[model samples]
Target chain A: MFQGYTAAELTSIFAMQGFAGLSLFSVFVLMALGLAIIFGQMGVINMAHGEFMILGAYVTYLTSNFFSEHLSSMFSLYFFVAMILAFIAAALLGALVEWVLIRHLYRRPLDTLLATWGLSLILQQGYRTIFGAREVGVTLPDWLMGSYAITDMIEVPVNGLFVMCLTILITIGVYLVMQKSRLGKQTRAVVQNRAMAGAVGINTEKVDRFTFALGCGIAGIAGSAFTMIGSTGPTAGQLYIVDTFLVVVFGGASNLLGTVASAFTISQAQSTMEFFLSGSMAKVLTLLTVVGILMLRPQGLFTLKIRS
Target chain B: MKKLQDFTRNPDAVSFAVLAIVLVFILPTVLEIFRLNLVGKYLTYAYVAIGLVLSWGLGGILSLGQGVFFGLGGYCLAMFLKLEASSPENTAIQSTPGIPDFMDWNQLTALPWFWEPFHSFGFTLFAVIAVPVIFALIIGVAMFKRRVGGVYFAIITQAIAAIMTILIIGQQGYTGGVNGITDLRTLHGWDIRTDEAKYFFYYLNVALLFLVLLVACWITKSKLGRILVAMREREDRVRFSGYDVSNFKIFVFCVAAAFSAIGGAMFTLQVGFMSPSFVGIVPSIEMVIFAAVGGRHSIIGVVYGTLLVNWAKTTFSESFPELWLFAMGALFIGVVMAFPNGLAGLYTSYVKPLIGSIRPLLKERARLYETPDKGGPDMLNRGTAQ
Candidate 1:
């Protein structure tokens, strides 16, 4: 499969594949980061995290529609608007779900799993009812569309570059908020020791809600970026949700850096496998390996929570 | 007199005979066939739910993989039915030889190699029970023996189901593809069209349900059940006490798989069609829902849970179909949030007290009537077991 290229060309091939993987990693991180906050921090199994992301995708869809009809030529920048809009929309919905349904079942972790699963089904069917069962195509702005020519021998898709940039911006933004800000301090404090944080006047309830909302918000951003590469349907989020959970789990839910590392590892492996094998085979192989490794390290790739 | 009273009053033994007789001889003759069919279907669900109660409620495994077991059994039975129906001797509504209809579209001329054993009823039956148990045992030993629990366990099993579905879908030439093995025929050389045959199946399911229930009751009453429930409550204690926790988990998982297979066989016989959806994540989750809503800890709850659940499915789907999912969402949230024990739990904790309080005013309808419905709460010492 690799005979045609010279040494320079082969280096460029490596570079191009590396670029492709980085973009995929970017998407995986954006999705898993929010799940890590919810499942990792709060100890709540939020199965409807993907649907929350889909809500973001829907916001992007609506934004694009608004751009096409009302703004006309400004369509080139609809993605920029869509990304922010999706974040707020998803965050608002996340907060609403937190207050209305999820808040009621805090102590019972397994119940949340079943309840959220039902919520996922409801959202899926609701989307089917509203958006029609078939997948809707979202139009990308022409300027952001197509590929970037890295070299004569290698080419990378431009949209992939765009997704990577958004991922970086979101990651840094999350990093700043988590590391530098007061809210970040409180959030981490609460995650480490909820009772102590409460005793220390951290307003842990607010932190919980905000942390959950932030994760949902990030998931929404992921959904917005996902419109470029994937289908936007009632079940579009389902495709990402499993792999997202896998990344989150494999990365170890409590650690952000672990998420990024595992995301790159799994995506690179999956993509490389896809190149060698078929798509389903790649997924099967990735999942089987993941399941096997998880059995060995049940706390995930990175362990937390006592008994060490 | 004491021996005779003891023999007559043992509810598990008594209920078994009563349920079998009513289902076999009485219900078919008295009620319209429609109601009988509904009751018949509930009996099959009861069988499935009992397996879930043991696997999830007792063993604390909370297996979301029962659907895969159910599908294995259903396909096994469906294969036998299809083979028997497709034979040259059977003339009515003839299907092509070796090709289930889905395979016709997929352009398959011959039977897949894996499906050859299913041509024989005994082999199909054996595969139904063996396949699911074998898969669970391999996966269980791989994962459970290694001590994977909680969310990771559920997610991994779910992924297995998803991957298997995708594999089955991709292999359209084999395994009946997505549409699954349908058009079931005569069971054990008896035509399924006759009302008598339907009664036979319904009775068979009822008998099987009673048998499974009895087995589950006996197991729950046994030392193993004590250790399994104890393991669920506190694994460290059991481990410290010299019991191998993984061995107990694997044992119950296999038992659960076998029961689910039996339920699947009964399900196919009643529903008259078997589809890939039997093994999908939805059905798997729904089984969990059934167990959850019916009180996962209670065995008798299994019967009421499956009945109430399927009843709700029929009612909601029939009456207000669009709002059903939302209602279902609310139901899960409600059951989990408000009532951890589900309807069965709700009944025992709230309704029983209110009824007992009210019963004093009614002045003994009988000098003493036996507890109805959920009387067997303490039969196998379940409350104490936990």
Candidate 2:
């Protein structure tokens, strides 16, 4: 397919492509991480996962507006505050959902799928009602609004770099929480053997509530980051849900590392295809490939200890 | 008739049979044109919901692919209507050539190859049903055969439905894309715009609903019905018992596809239009919610669910458009979380007692010997009845 590009131009394209792909992968990984935590660990199909992300995005939007209007001097630092606020807001909502509705549903995991799906619709509609049906544009702080020029022809959006950095920070934070912290140990114990964890006084109920909330909180952060690249509408979360699930399941459910890997792979493939094909076709091709892969390996790319 | 005995397995048969007879004879004349049109639309969705009830509610498949089948049926009929409208002898075509108004704006050339068959009404009707069934059978065989169930099954089906929506939207010239197929002339030789024709369409919807509900009830109580339930419980156990679980799934899926196709046909006839959004994930999920809210396991539940949902949609949207979806979402969550048995469940828990207590007085109609009509083959054991 390559025809008119010189070596220099080709090198520049590849360089710029890497930045775009990595940033996209970061967003995907963030979305999938939350899903993997809930679905893989609890065996609950949280269909409202995308809605959680939207809530987070809305939080970021609100926070940005607050910072812009009330404290303009801290405008650059506003994104940081917004990210934290989004995570907390989304997490609190998630916990409320867990305590109120999802608590009764752990016993009926399959029914939870329908219940959560319904919950998602309700949340989407709630947002639509309050915010209006049209999409909202979340403005980026001035410092993060521009691009970085690597070569004469290769320039990368500074926002993409910011997203990549945030992805790394969140990944490590999640890893430390899961691998190094007491909460992580308890969560792992519960996921590994729920009955045993309960017998050992691990409070599996609390673990589930926290895990679901944490996952939702991460979704919010992703949503906040997403405002940089995409529309923030009632239905915006849907555009990412399929891709999010593909990443989570295609990698290994419950495996953070696998989620990240799958995100990179899918994002790279999709971005590469976009260079040669139209946007919709790229998406179709990417989904077809994921489906084909799943047909062969139904357990997804990774089969963690508990899953087959 | 002697064949009435075939409905014995279905507990609701007596009521439905009596209702159908009355409907066939007099319901149309009694109902107003406006009410008739409304009920017609409801019936089409009812058919689609029944298909979901059988596949997802009863069978435990949570199929998000009903939209795919609905689209297949809808697009097939839409093509027929389009061809019928744009033909040379047709009055609409005499004024304008090549493209419908929507496509005229987009700059389409000749008809796409796949659209060629729909010019004939016979072919269109056949394709409307056949297309959805074939697609469902192929997809279901590939999926259910692999023993996919639960969230895995739900997600994949959702993906298929999503992709199909995107495909339809992208192929604007052939599909009418976002706008979908609208501004139609008539079906076969009848004028769609006339109140009489609308009444006829409504009656057609009613007839199809009765027949489909009868078939679904029959199948759910048959040998295949047992296997479907067993497959839901333990597919391997059924397979070990010398049945092809995959084949049963494919059969049910195909049957569901046909029901959905019929729904789409009735839907298009009543609306005089079919759009891409009609077959998207939202509609598919709406069907699932209808089944869930109505009580997934019952055909009667399907009827109640569709009516409840459509009523809420129209009423709420008119009063408060933005709040409608949220209210619906809340309704779905509330129903699923609080009333797992759905509204039909309330009837069983409460109303059935009243009916049971009063049953002795109506004993004259309740026949003897634990049998229905008489000596005909059990309706369900005959075929993939549902």
* Leading candidate by TM-score: 2
TM-score of each: 0.87, 0.91
lDDT of 1: 0.79
- Residues A149-256 of candidate 2 have per-residue lDDT tens digits of 866688899999998899899999998998899988999899888999999899998998999999999999998888888879998897788788878878968788
Error of 2 at B344 (Å): 2.4
lDDT of 2 by residue, B34-93 (tens): 866876787787787888777876677778778788778878888889777776554344
Predicted candidate 1 versus true structure: per-residue lDDT over B252-322, tens digit per residue: 88898898889888888887877777787777888888778788877777676777787788789999887
Error of 1 at A126 (Å): 3.7
- In DockQ, how does model 2 score against the reference complex? 0.58
Q: Provide the lowest-lDDT 10-residue window in model 1 chain B.
A: B363-372
**After superposition, candidate 2 runs with Cα above 4 Å error:** A1-11, A305-308, B1-10, B18-31, B89-96, B99-104, B360-386
* CAPRI accuracy category, model 2: medium
List of clashing residue pairs for candidate 1: A147-A158
Candidate 1 per-residue C-alpha lDDT over A227-295 given as tens digits, one digit per residue, 9 for 90 to 100: 877778888787777788888889887888788788888888777666656777777788778867877
